[model samples]
Each structure stands twice: as structure tokens, then as C-alpha cells.
Target: MASSKDAYRRKINQNSDLGVMRHQVVSLSFIATPFWRKNGIGQRSPATCRFPKVLGTTKGVKRGLVLPLVATSSQEARSGVNASELPNRGADRLREAVTAREAAFLAVEQSLMQNATTSDVEGTNASTDSKMSRDSPNASHLSQKFLLSYLALWSEARKPSRAEYALAKIISFNAVRQRMLFDYVLQTNVLREREAMDSVPRRIKSDNLRLSVSQRALLHTALAQYAFMERVPVHTIVFSTVELAKTYYGQRFASFVNAILRNLARYGEKWMPELERRRPAEYIVRPLPFPEDNLNVRYSYPGVFVAKVANQLMNQERVVAFLEAGNLTPQIFFRIPCQFTDTAELRAALEIGLLVPWDGSRLSESAARPWNIYRVDLNCADVDGAGDLVIAANTDRVEWAHALPDTSAKDLFQKLLQKFIVQNVTQAEHIYDLCEQLRARWNQRRRLERVLDLCTAPGGKLTAVFEYLQKSGLGDLLTEYVGVDLNGQRLQMVHENIHKAPGMSKGRVFVGIGRGESFVEYQSGFVVQNADDRSIVPSFDLVIADVPCTNSGVLNRRPEARWRLSERDFATAIPRLISLQTSLLTRALRLSRHAVFYMTCSILEAEGSGLVRSVLEQFPEFELSWERLTYTDTAGRDGGYAALLWRHQEN
Candidate 1:
């Protein structure tokens, strides 16, 4: 036991990027030229050049520490370097001598602006600063700056226009994904600046000017680019951010934003050197800040969610990897229908099948064919503005749709069957194989005709069942695929997905708007409609009750989920979701004659294993035939749980 414990300890101490930050900001340095070629490095991009080093090096040292530009000498220096002047190069040698002076100037400027700007952030002691009296009634136009707006979070619950929503994801997804890290960096930096002020020393107080929501949103997006998006030109980041602040707020707020971004460019670089290595517009999936981080802060996941993973796994390394995996945006998964055996399929199949060894199936031989599932290469997968597919997103769960691709185009997917977020598609693939195996077994004695999806809105799983039934030549065996969902708008997705598949259109499917926990009326209608056979009918042969979850396991797919969940008192939700899940599962079990597939896209024990365990203990009639609670360590996959509850029958 001692040796076993020691071995586990050794695994935790593995050489994972777990520890304090690597780079440290020694001090600010004055440089002749702007970092981004006064703007852009043109051909010499960030990919080939090391960051801060690309900016400029002095005394054999790399200095990324920054201060806002306020000069013609800097401009002359930049133009000179761009033109390759020896005199400008000579001036660059004096960077060390002017470092102290630049640092002092920055401190003085900040101290002068400290009292006025401290309140522009979330957490700061601004009570020490006195408030100005109300503006004169004649100057009411000044109040327009207070009207603030932020980028709306895209969710599965909301139905947004495809084009407009696509724009939102491009603007806000990564920024929101790294909200915690950037916010923490800003909050801490704000505190330090407040302390530098000649103000009260403790017990955090605030009454200073607060950042409008729009300003904060703009700031976060800017910081995400400035700090995390390494390949973005520094000039673009700073100029755009400053202008955004100016347009939304007054000129004062613009100055505040300029200063904050400048400090972060220097400070955040050292605080998060990991950004130096990441690709442009890409996300960070490794342990952030390098060396180490708390599970929640490290991945920007909620603390409750992290605690759940920690408690469930009881292994630090597994927990870290699982969290990291959640941040990995898998290459887009394109579900290609089996019937589309075009020239595109013949060519694209070999490439896709080789890239992904999904379910141990890939086309090495010319005789081999592609399955319905294929991961799309976005680079190769081009969308013409003239094309039908207006690409919604590359990473987000809510936008896993291409505006119904051009049917005429002879692309890889050949009119594309469907697009699903990695987690959803992964779950569907596993469930599809499981249900297929069950159907084969059940077919020996009975047809196993009826199926029920208890909560099937935006039906990915139900559609997978359709694919299985049609492809396996078992379309006739299943009579009814009943779908019950509360949301009418989302239930329409089920109809669309079903219609997309060949031979599985309106014939065998029945959908109704109703609650999952108490949907006996819908089941009754289906059974009565099919009472002609009278084969000792149960409401459904297979019941799918994939209940609602916190979605802790797929944080990368749904960047907004954690923040929204945090706001909804997630701590109290445990008992509530469990109760809801239990009732839904109970309804599913009662409705199923043969098997009830209970699933949740969650890693928490209570939601998955523990809940299943209790269900079995109470209802011994249903045995656990197959069950799995998986945590993803590898990238491009997601964590989730599934349990098959089957009623044992004697031969």
C-alpha cells in the first residue's frame, strides 16, 4: 500500500508544465522602433521569429517590457530601422541607458492618471478618489458614452442568424475563453497600480469611474490578441483597441485603455510566456502561465467543475490532462453520409480515414470505403463567399454548422451529411456502435422496433440512430423513433437532420413538444398508433435519456458555458440536476422494455457513475450491461459518461 501510494505520488510529480511563471519582467526598455515593424513584420512573421526577440534585443538580452509611445524620435527610429540605417542601429545600443528613465516616466504618468482611471476595471480601491458633481443639464450629450454594449454569448439555447452569429464567434470566442486569465492579470495589475497611488492602503474599496461593459469587452478582446494571439501585429492590436475605447467611451477612457494594454504587453508577456509559442488566433490548451496553475484558474474552468474532476479522478496528472483536453478544439468533424460515393469521397476518404483511426476503421486499401464519420481539414475545406456554406465557426459548440453546403460542389464530404461539435459527435459515434450491437442481438428473437429519445432537441444522437438503422440494412426493423423535447424551435433541428439522411425522412420518426420527465402522452400516441402488431409492446424498445448537464467536460466547445453556469449558483445545481436526471432516467427506464441508455456529457461522479449506481440499487430489475465514465487525456476528444440499463431475460 505504501509503495502504491508512492508510485501515485511519483506520477503527480511528472514533468508536466506545472509551476510558477517562467519569464519575469525585469524593467521597461526604450526602443527606437515599434515592435510590429512600426506595424507588421511583413514576411518575417511571429512563426519564424521568437517574441520580444523579434521586437528587438539589446546587450544580448530580450526586452518585451513596454510603455505607450509619445514621440517623433521613436517614429524616426522605426522608419530608420525599416530603411536599415546605421545611425538608428547606433541609437538602439543606448536602450540600456534609457531603460531606467522610461520606467520612471511610465510610473509618473500612471501615478498622475491613477486617481482618475482606477475605477475603469472590475476590482480596485477607488473610494479614496473624490467624485465629481453631476454635469450641467445643457451638456447631456456627454452621457451617451455611458450607453454600453458587449458581444452576446452564443449558446445552443438561442437561435441567432447564421451570418451575424458567425461574426460574433470570430470576435469573442477566444477572448471569452481566456477571460479568467486575462481578467486575473488585469485585476492584479490594477491592484498594483492602486497601491502605487498616494491613497488609502487596505480593505478594498471602490467608488471611482468603472469600465462600461462595452469598454471592458473591447479591452478583453484586445488583450486576448495582444497577449495570447502572438502572431497578430502589435500595431493592429493597440491601434484598434485604443480607437474602440475612444469611439465607445470618452477620450479619457481611450487613454486609460492605451496605458493598460501597453503595461500588459510588457507584464503579461513575462507572466504568460506560453503565448510566445502558440499559433495565431489559436487557443492555449497546455497548463497556462507555464510550469503550473490551479485547475480552475489554469483552464479558466469554474472551481466547482474543477473540484468535481479532481474528486472523481483523484489523480492530479489525469485531472490536468483532462482539463487541458477540454481546451483543445478538435479539427471540425464532418459526418459524411454513406451513400455519397462520389469521386470526392473516393479521394477524400483515403486521406480522412488515415488521419483519424476512428473505431479502428481507415482506408489503407483501394477496396476500403469511408464510414459516415470524417474529420474535415479546415485549411483544405475552403468556403467560397459564392458558396452556400457560410462557415459559422471552427471551435464553438453552438455554431457547429455550415449554412447547408452547396449540393452541387464536389468537395470531400460531397454535400456534407452534418456538422457536430467534437464532444457531441464523439458521443454519437460511441452510442451508435453500442445501439447497433444491441439491435443485432435483439433482432435474433424480436424486431426491436420502437425507440424513444427523452430529451432530443437538436437531435444528433437520434440522427446517428437513423444512420445506423439505414446503413446496417435494418431500417425496416425499427418502426418508430419518437422524439420528445420542450423547445419547439430546437425540435425542428431533429426534423432537419432526419430529412437530410436518405431513406430515413418522415416515415419512421415521431416528434412532439413535451417534457422528458412526464411524456407518457406522446408514448401512448405512438403505441396506440402501432397497436396493430401487438408484440407485447413496451412504450419503446430503447430509451435514450441523455439528460441536461453542466457541460464541464467540454469547456473548449462551449466557452460561455462556465461563466454562465457560475452565475446560476452552480453549487446548488448539483442536487437539482441530479434530481432532474434521476426523474428523467426513471421515466426512460419505465418507458423502455429492453434497454435504457442513460448518458451525460459530464465527468462528475454524481452525474454519471454515482447516479447510475443508485438507480441500480433501487431498481434491481434493470442490470448494468455496459457502463463507462471516461476522462480525456488526449487532445481533440472530450470526456463524458454512458450507462446501458438492460432488463435481464431468461433463455
Candidate 2:
């Protein structure tokens, strides 16, 4: 609508507006423009146009350059000339700056796209180092791999699975022999590193953040592998860890992981003196500077558990010995089944030498002499030597002189003899002795009838009872054998074991899934009712109530329990455990017309003697016939407590 000069002026102003928009979008500090000076739109003196202090250094730009649309000064705004009067140089310079800014914006967008694509493929093997040798035989490659895989899966909290047991077996293989060593190394390092960070300087600590769950697991595995892989070079350990980090996580984490493992490999021996000791026994038995203060850290036991043990043992030295014994891998013992009388079959089944019987008389003069025999004195007071059972060593039990570690013998016996072996195979000697005493008491009474086992899952004691009835020539006299458990799964296991036991008919053995306290409630469908159904639920001659306890005495076999258990757990669990035990025992006493054997694997008086005393207080009609508190140190067996009670007979 206007003349050619006005139209030209409008076109120049529009182009300048676009140039300002491009500059803002690209976030550039300033763009040089000789066109502005040539047109006299801004300061003509180059010295007067400098970059503002807010924008960083302008090394690339010429002097007197200014950002588009940014005001130069109040005087310049008031004195500005019209665009129509300005020359074409100003528009030309603006167009050039716009083109440059647009190009830069494209470059930034392209860079962001590339980064997103790269992040998509982050965990791929692109950044992995090739230094890790998968075929290295010096390292326990399988064990390390298994450990890493397992920790990755379980480091985050979740319910335990059977896979843990399988992993334990693989890690503890004789070929590896790194289970305890590795566990100790990993746990100790994790605790120490976590505590050590608190002591770090605040300034340095800001940059040094806490290790993440995955990071902690990886670090623990690396340090553990380094400690036990004596045959592997230190560089190999470091290299493998770095490669693992880069491959699984990314390069960002690789350097941090590599540094931790390298430091441990280099300075661990001096910093942690325990690492220098290769044998678990060495570390276990060594006296600490302050035994009470260092008990948890040195022994890898819960502080409360250590305190309780130290208190019970009275002497500090004895406490140490007891703890050492618990950590030692136990020896294995196998009892010959009554069905297999052939010595050759027995020897083949056990895969160990057959010594002369408890009677010194040999099967034949040419029979193999015992390899080793020592007359060790028996230390317990309850077990008395009787007739030929008593040796000059004041021990009632005869010696079978072969010694083998449990691990070596576990698999063989488990594979061959588990199903068909005696009612009691690989059972603690003290348990067998207790059963024998129970059998002797029954023989004295000369009356064997119904038997009830409360808290019977996995059916060990029930099997022993069946075997006793058969051997004592009272199998036909026993009308019923009942086993009860609250857990249906465990009750099923008891049924399976009972089915496999010899001299036991399926009809004679009853496995019930019910709470021991209210066992009669579950028997409704089975026609076992109140006094109206007299024949269905008859009185039992014997009731064996082996109640649940903390199992503190069997820590040697259940090492994982040490970590899973805590002092607070004990405090919370003990009251409930005692309540359940009391209920079970009371029910057993109610059902038993003659006698009840109350038993527990716990060595704690609160669970054993104290519990029995409480029961006696509640029911004064029952008299404690005999009681025995067996110590692992004294009996040379797993610790347990048993009290036999008999009902006071009415006139």
C-alpha cells in the first residue's frame, strides 16, 4: 500500500525481528555486526560496545558486537534513527546472524538425539574391557560367577528361596572351599566400609557418596574373590571386576569399582589382619584384643548372640572355645539299619570301615581291626556306664574310630542310605542315647500301646519310636502312632518318611495337619470326637513332645541363621516360642495316660529347664521322673534338653 522506500523499510524491520528471535532461541551471548555501525543504529566506536558481565567470555566475537534486541544504552534508544534512513548493511548482518544461530540450534538438537540413542543401548557390551579372561583356571571361575549372579538376584530384600541352599553347596564344594572365607570377607568389608565413611572428612565425604545396593554387592563379591583366589594374580581380579562393572552398569561405574577392589587387594592384608589368616579355624580361635567389644566383628555373629553365649559359658576362654566348636565343620556318623545285618552291605552302604561292635568281641578273629581307638572320658552326669557299655574311660558309648568331615560324607549318605537307612541315621549320639533310655524305661514297664508325637514334622523321632516297638517285640501291641504339625507341607514330609520306614503300615501311622494345642479339632472328620467316640480317640501310653526352639545349639550346620537372627528377634520370638511349647506339652500331657517326654534342641534354660519347671507348676499331678541337660562340650554331640514325666498313679 506504501511507496517502494517504505516497503523496503518494513522488509528490513521484519528481517531484524526474525534475527532477534533466532538469537534468543539459540541462547547465544552476542553476534558481531558491522552493518549496525555502518547504519549508525548503535555505538559506532568499537571501544564503547563490550559484552555485558552476565555473558561469559566473548573470545570468538569481534569487539563492539552486541546481542540482537538487547538495549545498548538509554541515550542510544532516545537517539535512534528510523530503519528507512538506515543503510542495507544492518539488514544484511542480521540475516547472517540468524542463519548462524539456526545452524547452532540444529547442532544442539542433533547432539541430544544422539545421546538418547546411546542411552537406549547403555547396558550393551560396547564399553566392556577385553582384559577379563573367562577361562582363567587359577580363579574359581564357576564359584565367582555363581556368587555374582546370586548376589545380583538377592541383594535386594526378598523371601529366601531354595536356590540359596543349592548356591551354598556349590560355593562350599571341596574344590572351592571358599564359602566361609568368602562370606566373612564380604560381610566384614561391607560393615567396615559403611562405618569408615563416617570418619571421612566432611568436604571429601560430600563427593564420596554411599555405595548403592548393586555397587555394594559387586564390591563385596570382588573383595571376597580377591581374598580367596590366592592362585589368581591381583591384576586379574581387578581387571575382571572392572570389566563386569563396565559390561553390566556402564563406564561411569567401572572406575569406582576398579579402585575399591584394587585398594583391597593391595592394602587388605595390613589393614585387616584377619585376611592374612587363610584358615577359618585360625581366625575363629585367635584371641581378640578386646573379646567382648570385638566379638560381633571378629566372629561374624550377632552381638546379642555372642553376649548371651559369653554369659552362659561363665568363663571367657570357654565361651571362645564354644564359639570355635560351633564354627568348625562337624564330623559325620552313620548308624547301621536293623534290616541290613551283613557287614559287607553295611560297609558298602556307609562307604566307611566297619569297626568291631560296641562289644569288643570281633565278628571273626580275622575281622578288620579298628583303625583308631581312644578311651575319651564322658563328661555328662546323666549318662551312666552300664555293664559292657561302660569302658575304662568312664564313657557309656563305645568308639567307632573312623574320622571324616561332614561335607565329604554328606552327599554319599544322602544319595545311598537316606531312604532305606535305620530309623535314625546321622542323628546326634545324644538323641540316640535318649531314645535308648526311653526304650529301656518302656521295657521296665512292660506295657507298650498307643504313641503320640506332638510337633512331629520330618518324622525322625516317630521313626525311632516305630523301630523301638519292633526291636522290643511290641510292634503288634502298638495300635496307633500319631504325628501332628501345624504346617501342612511339613506334615506331608512326615507322611513320606513314615511310608518309607520299615515295620510301619500306612494304616497304623497317622499324619495330621493341625495346631498341636487344638489337635482334636482337626480330627472331627476322622471320627475322633469327645468321650462319645471312645474307640476313635483312645488314651496313649506315651507322648513325645519335641517342641520348637531357637535352635541356637545347631549353628554349625545352619550358618545363615546367624545373620537372619537378631537380638530383637530373640526377644520377640522367645515369648511366642514358649507359649507354643507350653501349649504343645500341655496337650501331650492331657493325651498321655502314662508318660510324656518333653524335649528341645535349645540349650537355653528359658526354653528347656525353665519351661519344664513351669509345666510342673501348672500340673502338680505329674512328677518329673528324670531330666538331662546335655552340653555339646560335655556330651561331644549337639546340645539338647529332655525331661521325662510320669503321671502320679491313683490308689
Candidate 3:
């Protein structure tokens, strides 16, 4: 029998990594032990062996002897044992703590399902007695998120795939101990911990109480991870947990937690497996259709549905191309010696762009012709504090006018500003950082030139371009650092922010509120046809067209948009958008020696790469060059954009 087990293991290893289901075989071996001895040896061992009766197999193998007799090579067996020890220990502990909680949670889910099924099965005549979904103690602890997490963990555990384990670590509980802790949290309201069950509020008393062995184990694992992962504060963890619990289970979270924790404290080590035995079938069989690419990019995302949405926008193949091509989230490049070399400085400047001094009220109130100013605050709740600062020019001017720090805090603020800017600033700051990188690249190419930003309103990228030019010694070539936009208000912002050369502030940057694709009349053939058109007069030596896109890449900034978006809307809009791009690019190509056309969108295949492809195909005279950007810690979340540069040489 031992030799036979060894032979089976050898066959498994020889088959190849793709074929060897190591964990499955190990589980099967355990299940086969009793059958192996019972039928193969034709004898029953002493009652000392603690084994389940269901170990019998479909093949003629009996339960008692099959598993024990199967032998593995010593090295293989040792490796397996070593690999299993940590998880086993963690699982065992988790089971001990969360078994009861598991049972309670399972009971709640079962009752809910049963009640739902009964309601469905019996229709209007279904008894109200079985109609209550949250009528168990564990119902308070169970939420859609919690249940999904549990289902994910259990589904992963019963299979050989490590995908579940990876997901389990992110969204579900990993071991039995974590569940035990979670159970305790659900069952207790610390202030009223001693209250009798009957005295509990009617809402609390009627919550679900179902759970099982595996779920309890899962709870423990989650708890263990929560306890570690040093980045988040414990209070934040507790707050998040409570919030999550309430989102799903409602009023019963406290009491459910209390009961689970008490059990964990008492019998965590002893009764884990017994509790696991009662795990629900739903927990084990839940299916996951999560995209593999998203799995790597967005580990913190909690729901599979959300992952599905992300997958539709950015497929794995594109994500891989983006990664392999080394285009990622761009870095925040800053010029030194500026007092406000961060988001705060950028924020105040509004239209000046880069890390410069700013006066928000001035930019907002300025009545100049071509004002380049805008803000984007990423935090959903804090609308005012979020947003990027945009201007159409370079860094030196921005720093001189806006971010010039006061004498008092100059040294201290400068020393510690980088840390705060990187760590605590708003979402717009991240965008500003990326723009800065582009600014640096622009400076690298054109050493000393009075650059023109033709379509530079709401000027984060514009300001970055300006600053990069300034730092690269191009300020001397400032005959005309012109900024043009149709918005008079934004141009006014540009006027108010520019302090270049004192009197030359008015002379160096000719702020014009005008259209790029126009001949003084500000009317292109397409615009004349549309009638609902507005334009400002503009043509320059350098044109930057960061055209409007679907804006799907920055969903975190505008979550309200995710639900509102659809393929139909995109289909209808893309043609119009492309027309606008063509209009801008045509004018840009003819007007400027070199032109850059860029947009921020994760659905790069269509809106970005496709757009570039279309332009190159249509305009044979214009040459296109491409560069990929960078994003950090976004393995799972999508934010890769495409920048296409078209240098127009005389045809």
C-alpha cells in the first residue's frame, strides 16, 4: 500500500506542473485513508484512528485503508508537510475562534436563502414566520460583502487554484482565527455586553444566527490579517469593519460579534475542524469571473462586480501592453527653491500651473481674455479642496508670481513640504505630478524657445509645460509665451497670474481668448455647419491639444460617471470627439512647427491608440511619435494613457 501511494505520487509529479493537483491529491489521500484500510487490507483498525466514514470512494476502494496506505517519497512528503504547517496552524486557530460565529453566519445565510426560496416557492401564500431573512443572531454580522468574501474564501479553499487564496487575502478571511475575532466583534456591543438576549432590541434579537465550520475558519483568517498589515490604524480598521458590517447586516452587528468572540477566547484551538464540518455548500461553490489582469492591478477593490466593470474598460491584454511598454503613472516633477512646491501651492495659483504661489480669489475673479485656470479635488466629499491647477506656461513664471513663499516659514516649509505634498495632498495633486513629468520631457527637447500653448485653459498641464520650459533656460527666449482659450474667464485667470518681466507680464504672454481652428472668424467648416459653435482667434508656433476624452480612466475622481457611461453613449460621442480632435489637430498641424495631441483615458484602444492610429492613417504628411507613462501601486486599477506627438514638416 505504501509503495502504491508512492507510485501515485510519482505519476502525479511526472505528469507536469499543469497536471499535478497537489492539494486535491492531498485531500483525496486523507479522504481515502479509512477506505484504503477497510477494503484493501480487509480489516478494521483499532477504533483509535479518528476518521470520517464518508472516506469511501467511487472506485472499489473502501474508506479505512486507502489513504493511510498511500505513500509519498520522503522528500515530497516533508515538503508538503512543511508547506501545510503554517496554513494549518492559522486555519486551526481561526476555526477554534470562529466556529460558532461561522455557524451563526451560515445559519443567517441559510435562513435568508431558505426564506427567499420559500417565498419564491410558495409565492404570496408563503408564511410570514419563514419570511424574515434577518431573524438570526449572525444576521447582524453577515453582509453582502462579508458573505461574498466568505464565499470567495471557501470556493478557493476547496480547489487547487491559488487565485482564490490571493483573493481571499485581499477581500476574504484567510484563516479560522480571523473569523473568531470577527465573530466576537459582531456579537458584542462593548457598553451593553452583559445585556440579556431577551432584553436586546427587537431588531437585534431577530437577526440571523446561521454559521458553519469553514466560515468560522475564514473569519479567524480575516481577523489575523486585519490585526497585522501595519499601514492602517486599528481605529480605522475597526471603523471600516463596523461600517462594512452595518452596510450588510444592519442592527445586529454588535451582538453577533459578541457571541463569536467569546467562543474564540474559550475554545479556539479545540473545536475548529468540527465547526468547519458544518460549512455551507454555497460558501464552497461560489463562482468568480474576475478578470486575471484586474486581479493584479486592484487588490484593494472589494467586489467582483466592480472588478467586472474595470475589466470591461481595460482588458488584460491592453494592461499587459501598457506594463510591458513601460507606460505608467507619471511622476510629479517640481522646480527647486519654490516655497510652494506641492499641491497647496498649485491649488492657490489655479491658472499659473506647477508649484507656484497662488491667489484663488484672483484667478476666479480675473476678467482677462484668455485665463488658464482649473482645479480638481479627488476626494469625493471635499469638492473644494480637490482638483488640479492648470496654466498654459512654464515653471519660473509660476514660482515667481504665485508660490513665492513668505520669509518666515520658508526654510521649515521647504524642508518638510515634499513629505506632506506626496503623502497628504488631494487627488488633483497626483494628476499635477503626472503633468509635471510631461513638462520635464518637453524641456528636454526644446532648450530655449518661447512656446505657445494654443488650447491651454484649465491649465494643469499647461502650467507644467511652462515651468519645464522655464527651468530649462527657455525663459530668455520669451518673446511671446502666448496662452489661448475660448473661455474669457479662464484667460482672465491667465492674465491675473502672469507676473513675467513685470511690464512684460502683459507683453511676454499674450493671453488671447480665441479658437485654434479658426481664421479670425473662429469658424471651421464643421463648426459653421454645427451652428452651436464658439471659438476664439488663435494660431501659434507650438500647439498642445490635450483633447477631451471619455474620462473613464479617472473613475475615482468622478464615481458618479461610472454608472452613467454606456457603449451607446461612447459610440455616439466618439465621432463628434474625433471630429473635434481632427479640427484641433488640422489647425495645430498647419500652425505649429511641432504639435502634441494627448488625452487621459484608460480605454486606450479606442479613444487613445485608435485616435492616434486614425490620425496617422488620414494625415500622411504629419509624423506621429508615441511615449508610454507610469502609474504606481495600480497593478489592479487602470490609469494608463497614450500621448501622441505629431511633428508637421512642410509637405
Best by lDDT: 1
lDDT of each: 0.48, 0.43, 0.34
Model 2, span 1-651: residue lDDT tens: 777545544554576543233232321111212222213354433224332331222344323322222222222221123424222322222223221111111122222222212221111110110001111111112121222222222222232222222222222221122223333343333222322211121111111123322233344345433433233345655775575455434544565555445444544444345533423435222211122335554445667877877777788777766666555443333334446445453454334432222322121221121111111111110011100111112111222222322443344344433454222111323334444555555544454667788677667677666765665554553457887765554565576667656657544677776556555533433523232222233278778887766556654543333432356556664565667677777777777777787877666777787888888887787888777765544223455678888777621
Question: After superposition on all CA atoms, what RMSD does each candidate show versus the true structure?
Answer: 19.5, 23.9, 22.2
For candidate 3, lDDT tens digit of each residue in 218-250?
Answer: 234334333332222333334433333333233
Model 2 ranges off by over 4 Å: 1-208, 222-249, 252-254, 268-280, 283-293, 328-333, 341-344, 349-415, 421-431, 439-445, 474-477, 521-538, 630-637
Per-model tally of clashing residue pairs: 6, 0, 113
**lDDT score of residue 633 within candidate 1:** 39
- Model 1 misplaced stretches (Cα beyond 4 Å): 1-168, 191-214, 268-291, 337-371, 382-414, 417-425, 436-443, 469-478, 521-537, 564-568, 632-634
Quick one: best TM-score, which candidate?
Answer: 1
Over 418-529, each residue of candidate 1 has an lDDT whose tens digit, in order, gives 4221223457555764665465456554455788887776676777766665555454534678888755556666777777655667567888776676666354444222
The predicted structure with the larger TM-score, 2 or 3, is 2
Model 2 local distance difference test score: 0.43
Model 2, residue 358: distance off in Å is: 11
